[model samples]
Target chain A: MERTYVITGAASGIGKATKELLEARGARVIGADIAGSDVNVDLTTLQGRQTLVSEVERLSDGRIDAVLAVAGLSSPTVATAAVNYFGAVATLEGLRPLLAKSDSPRAVAVTSMASLMPHDDALLDAFLDGNEEAALARAAELAAGSPEQGNLIYGSSKQALSRWVRRQAPTADWAGANIPVNAVAPGVVLTPMTASLTGTEEARTQLAGMVPMPLNGFFGPESVAQLLAWLSSEENGHLCGQVIFIDGGSDAVIRGDSTW
Target chain B: MERTYVITGAASGIGKATKELLEARGARVIGADIAGSDVNVDLTTLQGRQTLVSEVERLSDGRIDAVLAVAGLSSPTVATAAVNYFGAVATLEGLRPLLAKSDSPRAVAVTSMASLMPHDDALLDAFLDGNEEAALARAAELAAGSPEQGNLIYGSSKQALSRWVRRQAPTADWAGANIPVNAVAPGVVLTPMTASLTGTEEARTQLAGMVPMPLNGFFGPESVAQLLAWLSSEENGHLCGQVIFIDGGSDAVIRGDSTW
Candidate 1:
């Protein structure tokens, strides 16, 4: 039987890469995105999330084998936290019932190496505390302040999303239901989302300084897609709530053994 | 001249212990708390935080040497995130200018072993995103759900707070002003806060299971206070933005070279 999967941000970047790879591998892929996808739904609002969940349930007939929340934003903006943290979470939680109907359900979310960067305490607090409206408003306010502030929102959103995956993995809705939930923290990947940075020599140099990729140079979307596919596969049963960093050793270089 | 220091939550627990130790070392200590203190201030509200900051500035005549954000909440409550993350941050950030007046200014906050526990993504995001109202409301909602939920809030608040300190340490207001900022993450300290857990055999066993303190049994408040004092003293110059886990090998046991 072909595995049925729902992938968000499926119109571009790593999400699109994953969708292509999964489809080529004989999986039935339902691609959701803001535009130019099978399902057109904005992930930044509660209504948008509800629309996505209902659409997935209808498309899959109330059964889903895997869910890949790959849609995300890199630049700082008011919508960054809403999209990265809440958007990803809504996909998983809202589709959880459908995943439960499957014999082997698996889920994965996209975090980023940015999670290791400095974060604003207030932003983190609002998201964790479940105040989406306030969090979004604050994120927008920060975005208006400066690009650096936006970067902070981006990093904190990824960090919080990864933490959420870890926390929820042990709960009844996930690991308890035999649905292994995990996240992938990737380094700089050559995608449309990062074209602005990779295209500019100075920006690339500055990025390299901030995150020294001890492995090869920057990664292709396919490199990260491969890892995401495996984690979301039925073969992956034991691993739960892990944020596997496929960042070409960026996390290793920055954090070192301090967190170990 | 003896250095003057302001310590919040000084009426009890780690704050009280830190105050006693600092005073014994011939430093002038200003204790702040809800009651029976040199300064009566609640750290859970913005107004409370503002009052504490203004009082300290007035008392020090705007020439204080150090600030210790030791006031914190362990149990799960809506106030946990507010007091633990925002309150501590407000203390340090609000009083930053005054500390700059000293020849060698230092600041230390009390985080906990709880930081290692599973945390809610929403709560962590809200706090880190700087959305205080939403974060507090979400925390209260979670507290209404269960104690375990409360535990998650407590742990995440500490984790976010520590991250905040790390993020701000390298900035102009701190290291640039010659003030070192750091946090102490202690494990299983024998304080009034842990009386219920340490007092019960079952709770002790459960705690041991969650965090194996291989180095020693439960520690006294003074043990943690000693570390805080050193971190806050002029003797500490080069170290900044470190959440040193003085947890008797709990962090070592749990994370174990993975983050190294």
Candidate 2:
């Protein structure tokens, strides 16, 4: 039986590539994006994600099998949380009903290597004290300051998200529910996002020099798409809640080169 | 050349015990808390922490060598962000100026094993996409209407903080800057915060059986504090932005016992 898949951010980058790959493998693919007509929706807003989820659910014909949430924005410091954090959550929550209905469901979200920034105890203590509203309120305070505040807000968000995924493994039986929730933490992928950064000679050179990759090259969206295909497949049941790295060992490369 | 240290949440539990241990070792210790004259301050509030930082700076007599941020709240699932995340950040940020004045400086924060809980990719991607505020805002949304919502908020905050510490390692130079930042991630310690969980007969029995201890049954704040002391010592310059687990082999035990 052919499976049904709902892929977000599918107009371009990893989502576009994954949509093609899944379709080639005989999967019924429903592609959604902020910029495309496959299913016009904004992932960042609650209403936008609801529309996307509703479309996916309607298109699935009652047989949705997986969700690949590849929709996200990348920035050096700011504007990341709006689309990456809230948009992704809204996507997941919106798709919950469809996921619960499926026997072998799976979900994959995109994370980054930048999630490894450092902070002091006092900062962390305050963050852990609030709920969504309080958390948002605090986030406003963090966002209100200049980006030069000497803290990587984007990295902190990813770290928190990665840890949350790790914790969710035992309770929410993604496997039992026939759902696998996994993430891909890519490092230096050459997407439209990276194109902008790489356009600058200084940024490109600096980033390339940091990686010990065979060609000193970055991974393309298709590489991450390939990983997504495997993770979303039924054969990959054992790898639930895993944060698969698709950045050609950039993590190791950076670690080896950087001295504390 | 005796050094004076300030410990927050120092009136009870790990904070109090750690204070006793440090003072016993002849380190000049000034106890601070939400309600104490030496330095009564609530780390969760920005103003409260600012006041505490000013007092600590003034009282140190020009020698506030290190701070052990043992002060925190551990409700099963309440505003961990306020007390744990933001409070820790504010406290450290406040202390940074004081630490800069000292010749050799160190700081350590206490964390929990709960932060190890697994999370999914979608969540991580959401967190990685935005600024800190955006990610935290999305985290609040993810945690809004679930029984495990508290866990989501608290664990996410700690994980965020932990990740921040790791990233800071490469850039933060304790030897060069004259200050060190590290953390202690203890597993199942006998602190007042954990007393409710471990105090009950059923809970105690279950926890005792679960302890795969190599040393004693269940390590307390004292054992963890001893390690904290070492990490905070000037001799331990190399160790920075690390979370050392003092669980009586619980991690090893879990590994050995797991069949899945």
Candidate 3:
């Protein structure tokens, strides 16, 4: 049977690649992003999240097989936390009822390998605690306090989002409903969001030092697109609450063997 | 060709189940344990690790296909750290050369869902630092100190071992050499090691409260064995430095999502 999927951040980057891959495989894809997609709405607000939920529900006729919460931000600011953590979580939770209608429902989000980097505890705690207000406040404080703290916003937001995945995947609404929710933490890809990191020779060398992708170095979105396709595919069973890293070997090089 | 595997702790529990599962599938398995296996050798000591490596090398003509470092202990003592961390690392590292000779080489070990539990930092640090003596001493101290600290022994040891897999898989010796190293973190397997936790209703209830395996609740060894087999099998190509959890949703229940 043909499957239908709702993919956020589908305008470009990994999301676009995965959307195209799924479409090529004869699946229906409803793209959602800030602009130039089926559902164009900012994900950093309650209204936008509600709009996405209602629109996706209408387009898919209230039966969505999978939801790829691929919308994310690399900015070192509070907005990153809003869109990455709260935005992603809202999209998943909202579309979950639609997902539960499918025989093989799966939810996967995009988290960055930057999640392995050092982050702010206070901001991370707020995110895990599910306090959007406090988390945003703390993110702003960190952004305004120190440059290093500002740099930590992206990592902390993604880490908190990952933790949310682990926390909610097994709950009654998800696992009890037979929905498999997971995440894919990719290393630096040559996405426009990461242009600064890979555009210059000096930037590439510095990135190599941090992520150390020994397998194939920095890769394109197509490499990660396949992994996401597999995770959402019906063939994947028994892998619950995992954040599979689709990096060349960034997780390995960074000593991310199994730190939980 | 019938793939050959060297599985430690093959006399009982998940290891034995995995050994049997592979053999039933027409795969050749060389079981290793303290007693009652093809190669009887203790895995808690450096000498034992070396002995097992040499015997497997000789038995398999120094061209072993895969090594499953399944030998582990749940005891809140220094030996748990010694066997679970140092011994396991030595076994994989020692057997890497033999594995490299195979057409498709793989390495996997047993971590636990307990890796998500709170643990001793100094002990974990010592293990990651690769200082066997210091790690053991710290483990001993924790074991002798508060009972709370003692409880962290097993978790800390397993966490360190997971870290080691992540740390080495991306390096020149593992992924760079065309070999994939990973781990499986199971939760509350009904093995002899966990008899105390699953033997009675009261114990089972307590265990559930702690680990919370909501999906099919307290699964048997065979469930995890298949996952280990896949990790060591030739089919797994892109997954490196991962500690895939086969714990029936315990990882998700414990909020252990995407943690580095």
Candidate 4:
């Protein structure tokens, strides 16, 4: 029997590409997305994520091999966090039980290139403490007042989640559990999001200029999709809690110069 | 005239040690902390940080050389971000004007060993964005009325800040502004914070076992203070945004592990 995989956000873009790639390669795939026919679960809510896990469990018939969580929103900041940050967390938490049944389960989630921003101490501590209620309160407070703060809140939420992956990685006992986890960070990708940025000339110019290495312009969805597929494969067992940057060598161009 | 310097969190621990070390070398040290009189300001609040900047400006008397933000908190996570994270940003922003006035001004901040935690693309982007208000909001949302997320917030915050520093260091234009910035990550020190950790049997056992190398237990404050002083000197111009780890070879030991 071929190994099976489950991918979220399979309705479009990278997620769709992943589904086609895996299925074409003979791996059984259970595509989960808000728009998919078989698994139309809105993963932004806990219940929706739980349902996704249940569907994957049933599809795998007691042997879901891996989960590739590409489900996310690509809006300004708040929308991004609602789906990408908390949504990913809910999906992971809900899927843990089913994944545990696999002989060599792995997971890879999607995050953005924008999370490179800076934050001071108080804000960082609140996120790291992982206090659910307080984090929500803080987010609401910041959102109640301004857009700039809300944007930072979105990025910081992702930042906290990333660090949580790293800190917990050392103690995960993944080897014993036969599970591995990792993340991927992609730079500018020409998706519907990129089209939206072009709505304003300033936004388009600024976004385009941010990339140091000209990959003829920017990466497309297919570029990121390939990387995600590999990360979700059994061939990637050794890597865990790492956010590999696939920015067409843009990050490398700043050798000795780039801070991150 | 003796070269003048400012040290916050100077009442005890690393701050106090740095102050004494600098003063011993004939440097004029202006100590500050909520617990002391030279300057009393809470770094967590914008207003408090402004007061710190104002008082430091007054005390400089047109002879300020460098600012060392060693002030930090040791609470589980939230408090750590409040002091170590926000305090650092507030102080730095507040001191920029004064630093620009100096002939060859430089600044250094302290981070923790816990910053090695992993991060995702979204979080990394958020951190690199550097919008403080947004950071606070996202932090609030993540904490979500709970306190647990705050425990791990420090590592996340530091990672984001460190990444930002790295990003900023390459082209900060601080030299043109007559100021430079740098940071250091230290391991457990023989301070009140470490002492408290020692008080807890579980923490002590866990930390003791976690020390990767044959460490000489916790490092003395002077060891780190010396590093801070050197980094702050006008001589270290090219070292901006560099986060040097001073853990008595623990980081190196981990690097050599066969696990990787």
Model 4, residue B102: C-alpha shift (Å): 52
Could you tell me the lDDT of residue B158 within candidate 1? 89
Residues A33-76 of candidate 3: C-alpha lDDT, one tens digit per residue: 99999999899999999999999999999999999999998877
Per-prediction DockQ: 0.02, 0.01, 0.29, 0.03
Candidate 4 C-alpha lDDT tens digits along B1-260: 56778888898889999899888889988888877748887777778888888888888865577888888875544345566667776777677777766776777788765666543333334545765555556555545545545445656677766554554443434433545566777767778867876777798777866654232345568777877776676544433345655553344344422111
Ranking by lDDT: 3, 1, 4, 2
Identify the candidate with maximal DockQ: 3
Candidate 4 regions exceeding 4 Å error are: A76-79, A119-126, A199-202, A211-216, A249-260, B1-260
CAPRI-style docking class of model 1 based on DockQ: incorrect
For candidate 4, what is the lDDT?
Answer: 0.64
TM-score head-to-head 2 vs 4, winner: 4
RMSD of 1: 18.2
| Predictions: Cα RMSD each | 18.2, 19.5, 5.3, 17.7
Q: Could you tell me how far off, in angstroms, the CA of residue B67 lies in candidate 4 after the best superposition?
A: 46
Compared with the true structure, what per-residue lDDT tens digits does model 2 show for residues A1-260? 78888888899888888899899979988888887748988765667877887787777865577888788776533345555656665676578678777656777777666654453233233333313444444455666766633245555555545444443432334433545566777767778877876778898877666542322246577767776776677644333344544444344335531211
Please report, as a residue range, the 10-residue window in candidate 4 chain B with the lowest summed lDDT. B251-260
Weakest ten-residue segment in model 2 chain A by summed lDDT: A122-131
